[model samples]
Target: MNKSIVFLMVILWLAQGLYAQTYRKDLPDIAISKDVSLHFISPEPIQYVDISTHAIAGDLPLKNVLRLKIVPDSVTHFALTGSVAGIVTVVGESFIAQYNLRYTEGQAFTVPSQVNILPEHTRPLDVPGIALTSKEMQDFAMRILQQPAESTLRKAKAFGIQAKLNHVYTAGDHIFLDITYYNKSNLSYQIDEQRFKIEDKKITKATNVQSVEITPVWQLYPNTAFKKQYRNIYVLKKATFPGNKVLNIELTEKQISGRVLTLKLKYDDLLKADAF
Candidate 1:
């Protein structure tokens, strides 16, 4: 009954508030340098692209896959910027999906971290569940279908923010990124293991990249028994000077390893007209 009240309040809060989101980049609790430092923020995984791996992924370097290779048409940051579900109008430590409206830069650009709040505007009470991992999908689905009076709720540990830059690069371009996160451990949390294309920075583009699925990594099958269950949000970050002529590019998660993955530009370059 207590849980129902809390969940109900959350539902009413979201359903009643209908404020439109503003454009901005989401930064971390601490400040960072944009040049050589990459902060691994915890961003909600795009579940539609979630993949799973069969066999255990052996020792692999994360840098090989998470590097940025192309410039994006729009840079968005999913972070904390809204109101607490059951709290007052003032948004102090609320989570938000920050979409930064920008294009690629010939030179590196730095976005400052500011604790900006979305102005208190009339918001619909029916916003979707806060972005989370696939396993958390059940909760999201529940929030959408079940009424607050009947909802079963599980609280989350912390909210996270991540930046996605859409870009296309050409051949012969090189990238080097140095990424940093809250703490190496806090930032390494990941899910969906099929997206990693493991290799060195020296090799620019290779078509034959191995991929996997989400079911295998989560071990969600009823037949299989497991001791621990994990819920993670991985932040795939690009340091400085990603690779060349890369297009239609985005970060993905591998099935078995829970690492960040990216597609190479050897095959195609995304034009401004074709970008999402």
Candidate 2:
């Protein structure tokens, strides 16, 4: 063989070997079957999952665990035809994982423990710190509920119903708003809707007022009716608005007695939020 040709062949072989090594470092293949479930356990709660094909079904039985199984119909087809391969992606709070899926005939496989899958990239830290899981945030909110009221000046009343913003707490990347409702009337208060929004501090007939709605990450109370008094905690992502904007917590009542109450908070109120 010519010297130049021999050198070219040697270079090609080396390149192929390097490619194989890189592929070997990829995530382990997950074996799935129709009769058994394959579980992927992570350190953090899984936020999202993507399956390449419909032949595989996936679910989160727990916040940090993902279960995957091959569809029964697909299993029969695979048995008659051949094995099918696809990709599975799992996204967590701090990391992203990708796995090669292999469909086979026997029992499915489960991870013995939490597996440290390679992350595609590191996620940047949010303002204060990493956000807590839903359960953790709920537990913290319950503790806040037990604390004494911190503010009495932020209040609104109408039709013998009073709405007050009692306390504001901050933890991790979230803000907790403690509020209470007092019904002084003999009749019960049936809540029709509760809205949180940021709107212009002042509005005029000629000016176009713009309002932005804010959704709570979680709430401690789900009840809508109260005879005497009720206290609730709402969790929201930590955010800041311009000084000209105000945060409005509005509550409306159902039919017949259509009463409404709103508690407004200025930017300073959010600045006063105590650390949890």
| Model 1 lDDT on a 0 to 1 scale | 0.26
Residue 113 lDDT (model 2)? 26
lDDT of candidate 2 over 87-109, digit per residue (tens): 77887765677776666666334
TM accuracy, model 1: 0.17
Query: Which regions in candidate 1 have their CA more than 4 angstroms from the true location?
Result: 1-34, 47-96, 99-217, 220-276
Q: Report lDDT (Cα) of residue 85, candidate 2.
A: 47
Kindly give the stretch of ten consecutive residues in candidate 1 with the minimal lDDT sum: 49-58
Q: Each model's number of backbone clashes? A: 42, 0
lDDT of 1 by residue, 67-150 (tens): 111112112111122221111121111232222222222233453322233323212222243322333433423332232222
